[model samples]
Target: MKFNRTAKAHWKGGGKDGKGSLTTESGVLKESHYAFKTRFEDAVGTNPEELIGAAHAGCFTMQLSFFLVEEGFTAESLDTQARVYFEDGSIPKIELELKGKVPGMDESKFKELATKAKENCPVSKLLNADITLKTTFES
Candidate 1:
């Protein structure tokens, strides 16, 4: 199976005075500028980086949930947060933290599943950021 996603940006003027608009092939539109703080930061909308983090966290959580269920563990809930750090002259880093309540999964097993999800998620493969994952399981 194959799928494609597209997002485009249009910018005007120089760096500090420049402004832009971002639109997804899916039809989501956003306004952006340096003063707004990101690709889309003003009354316009969220930035690409923020959207990336959101996607990563949501995808990772769903993958982990499925893996846990396949292993005969049922989770009450799973919450994941991702932090993406970008440096001008350096590679970006993404840190993922997840907390969950699994009825029958021990910490060791939970950690294993979490690691697997982090490594195997599609977003993980797409990211150039250094990815780090930390998970906590509650019984």
Candidate 2:
């Protein structure tokens, strides 16, 4: 099966003073700007890089949750933080941090599942950067 999603952005002016807006084919509109900080800062929209990180983190967490359930374990909560670092002359690096509370699951197993999720997630497959995963488990 094949599918596609569309998002559009419009920018004006130079990097520091330029501003932009993004709209998904699904109709969600956001504002962005360099002055706002990120590629699309608080000028009113979302940036592509930030959105990518969010999607990757969310997808990995959901996949991990499903894997846990399949292993006969359930989590009380799972929180993921994805940091995308863009340096002066190199590809961006994505660092994923996950913290969760799973009852009756050993830390070793949890780590295994988290690692699998990071490795197998669709977004992870699309990126060409250094991906790192750090997970913390709690009973």
Candidate 3:
């Protein structure tokens, strides 16, 4: 299966004082604002890294749920957080922390499924930075 998603951005002025708005074809981010302050400081808006982290967490959780059901386990709940770190003018690392409850599944199996999701998910595979995962399972 092949899917193509479109997102565009418009910016005015230069760094530290410029403003930008992003939009996606899905309409989930229609004219969302972002800027240097949003990226480097605690400004009132979304940044590219924040968007990426959201995407990663969402993708991984969905993938994990799919695999869990395929393996005959039901996903009671799942929560994931993706933390991105930019250092020295480049994105260096992304860390994923996952907590979940899968009825009738053991910890080892849960970890294996989470690892597989992290390794094979579309966003995780597409990223260029280092990715690490920590997971805790609830029975």
Candidate 4:
């Protein structure tokens, strides 16, 4: 199977002073505002790193759900957070933290499956940085 997704960005002026808007084909991010402050400083807007973190978290969680189903278990809840570590103008690593509640799943099994998901998720595979997973399972 194959799928294609498109996102557009528009920027004006210099790198440090320029402002931009991001739009995805799905309209989920219709003209979302972003700028140098948003990326480097604590500005109240979206940035590429934030977007990448969201995408990685979403992909890994969904992949873990599939693995859980295959293992004859269903998660009551799964919360994942992805932290992109950026340094020297590059992303050095991404950390995926997952907390999940699955009625009949063991901690070891949950960790195993989450690790597999972190390795196999499309976004995880796409990134050229070190990826790590930390899992917390609740009964």
Candidate 5:
């Protein structure tokens, strides 16, 4: 199977002073504002790092859900926070913090599955950075 997705960006002016808008094919981000201040300073706008974080979190969580189902378990809740560390003009690391509640599940199994998900998720595979997973399991 094959699929494709796209996002468009329009920028003008200098790097630090320029302003841009990002539009996604799904329309989830329809011409959303993005700028240097938004990325490096406190501003009311979205940035690429945050977008990557969101994608990583969503992909990892969904992958974990599939693994859980395959293991004959269902999660009552799963919360994931992906922290993308941007330094020296590059993303050096991505930390995925996950908390999950699954009835009749053990910590060992949860950790195993989460690790697998973190390694196998599409977003995880796409990025060239160190990825780490921290999981909290609740039964």
Candidate 6:
């Protein structure tokens, strides 16, 4: 099986003064506005790094859930935060913070599964950056 996702961006003007809109085929982001200020400065709207973080977080969390279910366990809830670092026009690293609870599961096993997810998630494999996973188990 194969799946393809698409997002398009349109820009007007130039550089810091330019304005842009981004849209995805799924329509979740329909003409979402973005600009240099939003990317570099603190302004409203989305940026590439933010979107990457969201994608990583979502993918890792779901992957963990799937692994747990396949192992005859279920997570009560899972939380993940992906922090992307962009430095000197390059993305050097991505850090994933994971927290979740699965009934009747040991912390060691949970951490092991989370590490596996980080290594195997599609986005993690696709990204050209160092990825690190830190997982915490909830009582």
| Alpha-carbon local distance difference test for all models | 0.80, 0.82, 0.94, 0.95, 0.96, 0.93
Q: How many backbone collisions does model 3 have? A: 0
* True lDDT of residue 138, candidate 2: 88
lDDT of 6: 0.93
By lDDT, the better pick of 3 and 6 is 3
Candidate 5 residue runs with Cα over 4 Å from true position: none
Alpha-carbon RMSD of each model: 3.0, 2.7, 0.9, 0.6, 0.7, 0.8
TM accuracy, model 2: 0.82
Considering TM-score, where higher is better, how would the candidates rank from best to worst? 4, 5, 6, 3, 2, 1
lDDT of 1 by residue, 55-127 (tens): 8999899989889889998889899999977578444899999999988778999999999999988999888
Q: How close is every model to the real structure, measured as TM-score?
A: 0.79, 0.82, 0.96, 0.98, 0.98, 0.97
What would the C-alpha RMSD of candidate 3 be, to one decimal place?
0.9
TM match of model 4 to true structure: 0.98
Return the clash pairs for model 3, or none: none
Worst lDDT 10-window in candidate 5: 130-139
- Residue runs of model 4 more than 4 Å from their true location after superposition: none
Model 3 regions lying over 4 Å from their true place: none
Q: List the lowest-lDDT window of 10 residues for candidate 3.
A: 84-93
Candidate closer to the true structure by TM-score (higher is better), 1 or 5: 5
Structure candidate 1, residue pairs in collision: none
- Per-residue CA lDDT of model 5 for 14-68, tens digit only, reads 9999999999999999999999999999999999999999999999999999999
Clashes per model (N, Cα, C within 3 A)? 0, 5, 0, 0, 0, 0
Ten contiguous residues with the weakest lDDT in model 6? 130-139
